[model samples]
Target: MNNAKRRIDLVLLPIVLLAAILNGYGIWNDQYANSYYTTAVGSMLRNFHNFFYASLDSAGSVTVDKPPVVFWIQTAFAYVFGLHGWSVILPQVLAGIGSVLLIYFMVKPTFGLAAARISALAMATVPVVAAVSRTNNIDSMLVFTLLLGSWFLFKGTKQGSPWRILVAFALIGLAFNMKMLQAYMILPAFYIFYMLAFQAKWRKKIILLIGSTAVLAVVSLSWAVTVDSIPESQRPYIGSSETNSVLELAFGYNGLSRLTGQQNRAAGAGMPNAADDRNNRDNASASVQGSGQTGNSAPSGNPSDDVGMGEMGRGMNGMNFPQGGQMPNGGEMPNGRDFGGGNGGGMGGMFGTGEKGLLRLFQTELSGQASWLLPTVLLGCIALFAGLRRRNITMKHKEAAFWLIWLLPVGAFFSVAGFFHQYYLIMLAPPIAALTGAGFVAMWKAYRERNGWQAWLLPLSVMFTTIFGWYIMQVYNDTIGAGWSISELIAGFLMTIILIVMLNSSHPWKQGMVIAGFMVMLIGPVYWAFTPITYGGNSMIPAAGPTGSNGMFGGMGMGGRQGNGNVGMTPPNASGDADQSFPSSSSDESDVDNSGTGTPPASGGNMFGGGGMGAAGGRGGAGSRNEEVDTTTLNYLREHNTGETYLFATTDYNQAAPYIIDENEAVITLGGFSGSDPVYTTEELEELVQSGQVKYFMVGGMGGRGGNSDISNWIVEHGTEIPTSEWTTGTDSGAGFGGQSTLYEVKL
Candidate 1:
């Protein structure tokens, strides 16, 4: 037994190494993965106050959108590693790899060694899982926390221990803190598994489940309750909430809005209505220029810089295209003019979810991410229950049912949910992997024994999965080349046929054929998984595919550059007509100059540049320049500092994030992320200026959302605008405000 255990462990080493390479390779090249969260991690490391609230800036003005648990872990890592992109991303990387091992151990106890090995490989190679693990998004860590909970849940069921069950529920609660209601997607699976697998009386089972429920509620709501109970004056306003309430943020924006489309509302209370504000801004812009530029327009000469804010706002608010919003050069934004509350159509459609229907998962937009193995998983589900009698419920049957329960509802949710990114599909990976591993063994054994319908499931599953993979490949033929898909289809069908022919032969021949068939089935996903490392992936909205046209991967190609050519604003044509074709550069390097200063200002291209929505080592959009502050500007601000609490204040976090990351100083983000959160009133702003807490105010950029415009208007009326020549050097204005902005010195 000991020797066998050693050999099994040896076999697992290569799988672990593969996961590490897929998740950790080339991560150091990432300067700052998702600067929004990266900035928060940097701020949290400053002191205990920011650390506890998960503050987005060192000043602790407002908290991040999510709860603090994951950020706390990231902050600890930044503390040890000195807060680089790699430092914060390190936690998720480790979590992703750890999930692979957990899948192996969880399966090994009941499903045997071969099943565990296959399950681990599946978890490691799913494209979306690898894409998310490479970034600092909370999904990878959330998945890990849930998987750990599953391990405990499985152990409790095996031993019938209520204590282990309670521990499992507690972990789920912790996962809720990680991502709120997303963690609860697995609750039904846990509940059903415990009721079916535990060998207690019905009354005892009900009592135990009730106890677990209480524990889950306690753990899940503990942080939210504590944060909500604190006085509004003492704590920072909840970032994305409509009423400055954490509970509302969780249940509304991050919860129901995930299912139903996000409603148009300001981020906090005492804010102007979103629709009215949007209309007023549209009328203002149209009256000023009559150029059809509405709320989406940035300052002249820097058209594409603010396009990311539109993308960010749409992504957060359900892909609502601004009315009459024209891209630079008169190009119309994609996805039609339907604002909010509608289903995205097929491939390259809105939200990357494809059409909302039963076939949604099979569509080109989503299939390649994690659904490549669904055909096999579905067939495996049938094979697992074949020839089973209701009276004889074995551990294998119970485990299979647990994974199926896990897969179906989550799959259904994604199929219908109004708002979600492609990376959220990582939730489907574990169950698909588990069922694939267990089903393969069960069907193989049935085929050898000639167990009727079970005998053909193995071959049928391989053929279907192979064909499905070919369809996904064909969708990306322009980027990955069609010849590769053709080869896979031929090789996969041939292997399946050969495996069927060898059924009457010896065990070794049959096993070889089966292994060959599975290998062919894995070819596409493995290649898709490698695309992130090869071409680079979007750290902000992580998706896997080749970069070129806006197909399923939405042109996320060539070192993580957005493929749709939404680079910095599009430039005008020779005839002065707006060029509709947002042309993208073929190169794999950032077009913006670093300006000889080691610290690049996080401006131009995407809001976070290559680190945010901009392309990695490529042009973010056409005519985009580096938005980093020039040395002259940095020196001016430092020299003119008058002991203010903040270095300077900007309308939005985008204008402020780069400085926070580069300088590690207090820079106030007045409008929060998306520049839409109403964090202050004009009177409060006047008070801040009067007390000398804030002296330098940047008016314009992506700030002044909703009710916050009063603050900007007040500053312009009373303050003095600093001359650009005094602070700017060269062509760069040192501000990527997504629009024209003026610096104002506000004094009594």
Candidate 2:
């Protein structure tokens, strides 16, 4: 047993190291990566108030959409590591590596050493796993937590310790705090698995189940309950919920709305009409029917609503522009730009909106990332059932049943569910990896033990995986290009030949063939995973594949340089009207500073040059310039400050985060993300200004959410814009496209 254990450890060592390296490599390059969460991390570190509320600003005005569990973990690390990007991201990297190990241990007892090793390797090489682990995304921590729960539950069943089962359920509850309803996705699987596999008597088992569930419910709601119990006036506004309730957030925006496709009233892109009728009614006066934006709605009568339209004549009459409700005379209101448009490819495929039900998971966008070995795992599950059918359900068969159950419900939910993201696929990885490892071991054993149809199972699994891989290459051909297809085909053919050799060859050659075949099966995703690292992968949307031009992975590379164009997921001409793709240069050259502000310098052109919705390299118009707060602006705010809590105010966290990171000052965001969440009313902000709590207001470009109309209108009507000449410095005036930051002074 000792010798066997050592050999298993040796076999697993390399894959573990590879996974660790992939997850940690070059993780620090994108400083303040994904300003959305990074901003929150910086703010949460400010005080206990920000920490508890998970506020976007140190002032504790508004909170991030999700709960604070992941942030708590990140904050602990940031405390020690000094708030650098790596400080927050490193915890996720370690969590990812630990998850891989847990999956190995979780499967080894039932599947044997061979299956355990394979499962770990499969997870280690999965692209989405690599992507999420490397970024500051909370999903990695969430995935790791679930895997840990699985480990404890497996141990509890084998040992008959209700304590272990309690711990397992408790951890799942903690995971709920990490991502709300998403953490409970695996609960049904846990319940069924425990009931079938535990050694307890029927009555005891029922009691254990009920008690553990109670523990889960309590642990899950602990944070939500605490936050909600506080008086509304005392705590930060609960973000992204219809009512200002965390429970509603759990059930609505983060729960049913996710499944039902109801856009979050306070988060996401444009405020779609699909939102609850209450949101529409609440913002009725300000709400315009459509400007084609998604996350937050820009209000009617704001000149910003008609930004960049050559034909201002479209709806000028309806707009109540801040300047006495008069429309800014037409021919495009300088630098007005559109974002997040275009028909993304894979729209009609299996996992796309076009493909409605179970077949969706089989599509290219998903299949290539998490399902490389899906067919193999499914076959393995079937074989496990067949081999043990004659025997009464015992520990062995029950264990296999547990994995199958785990795979089925979650797989079915994501398959037919309305919403899907590449990162969400990480939740499915463990089960898929487990079955692949154990199932492959089972097939290999059946093949060795007999000269029956089971022998064909191993080869059949490889062939199926290869065929699916080929189809994935074809589907993503636009992003990855035809060149990748040829390589994948060549690899597939080579894998086929190796399988044949293994079937006919003697012992020594057979072992080698097995290694070669596994490598061939994994080569594509492995190669894809490394490509993201080589390019400083941006975490805009964590995914695995060739880098797209300013896409999730590709944009993570050095300063927004176009990706290799190898990734074909993006459709050619999918982005509508190239002319409108980016904001054109302004004739007013005064707003730009030629001085070296760092890299491209602080100017209009650099700001709008190459960013948009989901633009690669983290340079989205408003989001692109967050890492570097303009020193000039920072200095001016510092020079003209009152003894107040916040340094200044912006519509959202985009502009505020830079100051928080660079100046160590709290910047109030009037609206939450996209300026959508109603954190404070106009009167409330006016009171803040009156009391000298927040004295400076910054408004340039679109006010996030529906903030621009109200705040912009109020500031213009009640406050004054400090001209670029007075407050700013450099060869250019301080203004440019959507990315430029303009300052204003509001009088109490």
How large is the C-alpha RMSD of every model relative to the true structure?
5.9, 7.9
- Model 1 root mean square deviation, Cα atoms: 5.9
Residue lDDT tens for model 1, 119-210: 99999999989988887778899999999999999999889888999999999999999889999999999999998988789999999999
Backbone clashes (count) for model 1: 15
Off by over 4 Å in 2: 1-8, 264-354, 474-484, 494-507, 549-562, 566-623, 702-708, 729-741
Report lDDT (CA) for all predictions.
0.66, 0.60
- TM-score to native of every candidate shown: 0.87, 0.82
lDDT of 1: 0.66
Worst 10 residues of 1 by lDDT: 586-595
